[model samples]
Target chain A: MTVERSAPPTISEVAAEAGVGRATAARTLGGYGYVSPELRSRVLAAAERLGYRANALARSMSTGVSHTLGVIVADIGNPFFAGVVRGISDASRARGFDTIVLSTHESLDEEIAAMHVLIDKQVDGIVVASAALGPKTSAHIAEAWSRGIPVVLVDRAVPGLELDAVVIDNREAAREAVTALIAAGHRRVGFVWGPPIAGRPDRRRDLVDAAARNLWTDGERLRGYLDALDDAGLPFDADLVMVGEKTEERAIAEVERMLGLDDRVTALFCTETDAVTGALRAIRATGFRVPADVSLIGFDDSSWAAVMEPPLTMIEQPMLALGTRAAEVLLALIDGAPRSQPDGAFRHTLDTRLVERSSVAPPSA
Target chain B: MTVERSAPPTISEVAAEAGVGRATAARTLGGYGYVSPELRSRVLAAAERLGYRANALARSMSTGVSHTLGVIVADIGNPFFAGVVRGISDASRARGFDTIVLSTHESLDEEIAAMHVLIDKQVDGIVVASAALGPKTSAHIAEAWSRGIPVVLVDRAVPGLELDAVVIDNREAAREAVTALIAAGHRRVGFVWGPPIAGRPDRRRDLVDAAARNLWTDGERLRGYLDALDDAGLPFDADLVMVGEKTEERAIAEVERMLGLDDRVTALFCTETDAVTGALRAIRATGFRVPADVSLIGFDDSSWAAVMEPPLTMIEQPMLALGTRAAEVLLALIDGAPRSQPDGAFRHTLDTRLVERSSVAPPSA
Candidate 1:
């Protein structure tokens, strides 16, 4: 069957017909950034006459604005990314920008591929909840930056990337959680993390010093954990920490392994949404009640946490607010705002509050 | 600061360097459809020298092949959409197409705006879990088709659009749920739905004929609910059905109203994920233990449902399968495969099995 399709009128044609610069014509037609009322109407009138369209792609190529923000996140399976993306959606839409959501699934290669697509597609800017990046993997970000597309980091920031970022005070939050467990008379607090899984390249046994460079943001969290241990004069036990490899199933298996140990953990500190779910599932699988059997403190609050059997105690990072702030900063960059004013304001370390719920309690005698 | 950047090489440049047709170059670059070994190697070699990129966008405009599939969903907040999207992502990636995800948030205007973005972005095709389209609103779908972009519907098919769709037999699923409740000796069962909320179009006080055209697959589910009541020789109570408007707050309020009524409902059949959460929350708020105080059945089983206090008795739709089938059909359409064989296969209605859990029991005295 021969389906009838018309060749879409390009922006060059529209600009030529409007007798205006391609950028101005696109600004009016795409309904983004700024354009004068008089020129906007002229472009509209010409566009109507010529049956010109608001083709964001073609206009992006010509006028260098797509009005679409690229969002490359680390994990979509985790509900945490959904919340962050929702915030991006709200802010982007309110700013007349659409969002192109992609997930890295915790892989640097996938992240690079997605960035290529976004850069080639000509997005206005990007908000990256990036995965742990290895050294020498800076080409894609540099490529995007070279193309004048600003990158705003959210949730997890790459180590050496000098990009504006919105992140929770991970070390402090982790310390508070661990300290809370310690104050409750718990000496053996287990820690479950996303990456640096067993046999991974980044895993350095015996609690690597906070000064050391590595993949994954767990370094800060791990540092906080060590700080709490030192404050209470409790010896650090490396066996209590499990690397989840960014999957619920693997996390669950690791948690189960910890539970089966000769000296099992008394309290659990999960450092991500998937880790929390996996830990909870594993606890349930072991026929153990939360708080009663093993007190737990989870990072990144999700709706499931509130509705869990014994509502979970978690670190509630201001996710939506972080997204909003990141977008605002990104928008400013896109609008040609100076990188640093005289005051030099840059990194936004949003505070994470511990939501005290029924998941934690004093250890049983 | 001025950023020094050069325009990325286009596919035409790659094709020319490869000394092959655009189709052959695209086939090798996109990693889709089929390509011969020799031509693929030649294209790769040319891409390496010219730094020839896939660049879905430029390739889309020049060669009419944007290796990107647009996904416009209704509610990304709901886990249902997340599952469907995961399936879409999996299938699309495996088939060498990147997905661009968008949401309508249950608003027609937002839905229209999203479609405009997707269409203007020049996606290879679209899979829309469309919002309820009011009359005189078929223009955008028509516009996309006229532009040679095929759309496949998932979750629910828009009425009057002859687009290929993958949906569950919602009516049958609802009837089965209601029938199960009846068999459990519950006559005062309630139902909570998403759309057709107060003062909106398609708000028929009485159950409308099955032939009626409207949005959302709820109509079928509603019909099945009514059929179950009729089969059991019970009088239909309009009061038992509440319109949620697709938000947990509204659904919770409506559920609270049902609980506050002089003739309170003993059981609820929540028709969506948000409705289930709202109903569960309301039940908890009222200090009512599920299955003991009020037996409940929910649609679209979520992780929360599985971990609920008493778990939950709910309908588990093949959401991932629905997304997979939709993508498959869309790919076929994109490949210009024949619309039909001798059997005239088109609509794919996946099964919804009832997961029997502890949330349903005999009505209390």
Candidate 2:
């Protein structure tokens, strides 16, 4: 049999061939309303004969709803963010929402720009896991809100703005992790912190017996650490505390330096995944074994943590709950419910738990 | 000095204190609309006195465009998809779009549901990296198109559907990799393929034989492999050909079984990243060094491929370009431009190149 040789016809050509207006042809061929059955049949026949396909772009513009959801994340490479995004997708699909994802690369400007583009496209709702939330960003969101849009904040919280937010109890989780380490016969431990924000000031002070700088999550987590230490009757040592950036390389380097100092830390208390991964890698590279050469406790129970050589001991954040709760709250607000019930701030904080893994152990002599 | 202990003020309380209508006070304090100077000052004063924080959810429903983009991917854990997402985010942010991400988990039902929910929310456009596309899915997309929504397909393509799509030359890349093995003086070569799909009948034939199948990508790549064998004057061995699912463990097991057969293959061609990683691990586990015992070639030059103990020789796809092009095309189409010039099927194919690493070498006798 000879192969069929003919180009597919265009929508405009089909419209012209059928002697109908472009709009009529678009409506008829696209299977929409307001077209006479006779004219619609003619348009359909012409389209079939000419092999015309309707343009998706034009159709989307007229509909107003693109059947797409915009997801803004700090980074896709981070396994934690990846898991949360996965959870969001699963939940959204269950609710009939197609997703469009954008990564901010931890830039405030990029995050702001993404917001504008998604808004211009008129996305149904926005779910943001932002790294930095400045005053301008908050104002931009406020503008969208005034226009009757729905937004949910995931992972991180904006200080002043009141939006539907999903987050784990960072302070309580950190305190419990440190408390566990102390219970396991460890007194001296090092802490790693996140960005300095006004919402968490005590965490910074709890790092060392120093003045409290304006920091939120980090400070609260640090306070939990201190509370645990005080409860255990252990004196917090300034020399054992090191506060700076959070990453594997930086944490590893800091740990190495501290280990080489006159008074070395007996156990490690890492507040982030990066810090924990770095500490483990550093310990391995130095030919030291976990819980044998040094005991360790970490935050954020990521997937890789469990699969690591000596499975990590960490605080497990309720990731799926965070996404589901955020979606539910945002949907509720979209349905026009009062922000509060004449009681208190409409804030919900999910609890976190400590998971004992192979990484943590009794203090090494 | 006594620390101040008082409850925060409510929105209605602020409205009463400001002596303005509740709606006007809510609008002003919530930053939803334009307010008179005198009224704005009064509302601000009242809010400050009441310590009122505007609710994000309430504000969003009042706004039309939520300043969000919806992103859908198959699996976020897959580093390849993760990288593409990062590129989309980077480009989107540069253009000012906030992203909302969802994962379909390779389910068609989830894909359809996601589309519906996003539509209900009124998203501007959608970018989808679909798991698999069938006629029903295409029809659903056609419905969305009729409504004037823009969609950009990434990594995957649907036949007989007119939409903007971004894809790398998978077949050519696979063929080139196989050809390289032949050039390095390997006669007996084994093959590892991904899961077979029924919708792609031609692809199945290409996997079996080129003359009968004629799939654009798989056929071309299979032809490339046969071309190398033909040029080398090596007889095609049917027993050496093997097809298996795409997974590290499965690929490794298949390769091991193939190796156990009498007079087994001397070189291998892996068409997917998982298969390649599995083959590498199996080779290492078997105590056979790459290019020393049995030569190998991999498709898709992922980060881990380069960082592995012995760098992998593989095909490098233009991943970022694929996403950017898809976005640009969808945006153009949304702007009322024809899908293609001359009103016919528009197809664009990108070139793939082989990066020579240490993974390939002549077979050892």
Candidate 3:
């Protein structure tokens, strides 16, 4: 250590200066459990005198629980994830837990590495919006479970992993959103979404299974759209379903492709916030009006969506509830609750609401 | 611990199964140092057969370096902060480091607690967008330095603590922004911002010193605004400065208060993204047009600012650069680089530029 940098005053120094037992001094300074005001003040005064301060890391090593939760999200730049993180933080703090948040940026490899980092940090439990890691590539997650650390899934659940998950009913709500647009007399509607990973052919030709192999969320949303088309007695125009990368620029490109189709989409159903924003920019750039030129319904309501020229109609996922519930389940598991059968993981699916704003109207005849 | 849940097969089991020395098995399995392909594959196959996996915690205990960086920000919901975090994560990953990001939500206690949590986690270094902790309450920070962990400040520097900081020339940027509006012939302008703290007695006759105690970032911005007024020979009207909590609702309320001023301000200057958004909503709600009715300029350019009916002309902070630079500096310090003199800390001031779009005009003259 450098000579100019003297040692930081320790808990022992404060304890000795306050003339109290180490445990009492700790209770006074750590802000955990209980300590008498008189003792607290004495310890605080001594800490002030000797320059002793609270050291949470030291306490964690002794207590075995770091009082911190690790949260791994798909992306932090996305406002939807931001809302969920805020919800998690709000609930976590209320329950005396701090959160260590990491963004995977939608990479399975990054997600696995992040989980390892979180485990090293010794977070009590983890809540992740995973990258849909396949069973063959999921050793890190299984490792977490094997070590007795709880894990909760948010937004999307992996098919092979038996884990607690909190999610909104993506399929049903997506179908409802599309149905509403169909009811508004749109025969040609385009669905813009990210194609989940490929290579695993659905052995079971079931719609649910087909969707599950892709992103659990995207699959459900797609299934709902497909089911809505069937209910409306509309043909499943594969050309109208734009399955490509899930990025703002990619969404715009898909939209442009849909516009150039022989049966140009009269209505667009966007499945993410970035897609919606990008679609809006594309529509404006093409010299088209919102409802007047292209009716639209988007996913995940935002403050900006509300303030847009014509407020957007969106399927509002209960974002905060998803995060809070995930944390709740993970905490329960961490607090010694027995894990149910691997086939019977605790899964909570919240409902989403269609917020009807001015962005959608009857399609042109 | 349960009868049905057997203990995870340990490293020893894998080593024995692999028919290799413990150290060789460890190297092969841990992805550290060097191991031949044949040995690595053998060890991996044996570990797979035994359902054995590496534990990062065990590794961290031995190495004493978590290979993770802790970043504590004031607020994660703020887009400006979110951009900074994304930059930090990008830079961290590029250098084979992972970040454990924590949000203090502007609470000093939370920041301090977060610091302890990170320290306990054994992170290599820390980068903090500190809450500008008061001198009397900042021993926790000093303690970290005493323990030989480096901390780098972003956006604001603590006056009492000598630490490396990455910042923009907030005062100059503010003055230039305000000067632009002033030069546009707007004599009466509303300055909307969040008050530093609720109970701070700003009884000091000097405005420069008054703002410093609240937050370094806010104080510098405030000082710049005052300097602009002083330079332009305009009177400093305290009533024109709306100081309240920094939230959308509070901003709306403050804007309403400004509109109700005896000499209602002609134009508005917002100091944050939420404030800018709220001000826009308020203006729209009041049936006022941008530049035509109330010329406006906002701090922290945003995506929504571009999509607005009249694109906003505002100051753009190099948010990503701020995070990247701070992390880079801290990483340098962590690499055993000699510490510079405490009084001459490594200070980086990135430039802020005015992005002029269509939001500003000659005050309707």
Cα-based lDDT at residue B97, candidate 1: 88
lDDT of each: 0.76, 0.64, 0.77
Clashing pairs in 3: none
Candidate order by TM-score, highest to lowest? 3, 1, 2
Can you give the lDDT of residue B137 in candidate 3?
66
lDDT of 2 by residue, A255-316 (tens): 78667667676678877666776666666567677788788888778544553445578888
- Which pairs of residues clash in candidate 1, taking residues 3 or more apart in a chain or in different chains? none
> Model 1, which residues run further than 4 Å from truth?
A1-56, A132-135, A194-196, A199-215, A340-345, B1-56, B194-196, B199-214, B340-345
Model 2 chain A: ten consecutive residues of lowest lDDT: A207-216
lDDT of 3 by residue, B216-263 (tens): 887888888878888899987766676656678877777777776777
What docking grade applies to model 1? incorrect
User: Could you tell me which 10 consecutive residues in candidate 3 chain A have the lowest summed lDDT?
Assistant: A196-205
Tell me the interface RMSD of every candidate, in Å: 9.9, 9.9, 8.7
Best-first order by DockQ: 3, 1, 2
Candidates 1 and 2 compared by lDDT, better number: 1
Query: What TM-score would candidate 2 get against the native?
Result: 0.61
Candidate 3: stretches off by over 4 Å: A1-63, A196-214, A340-342, B1-55, B58-62, B196-211, B344-346
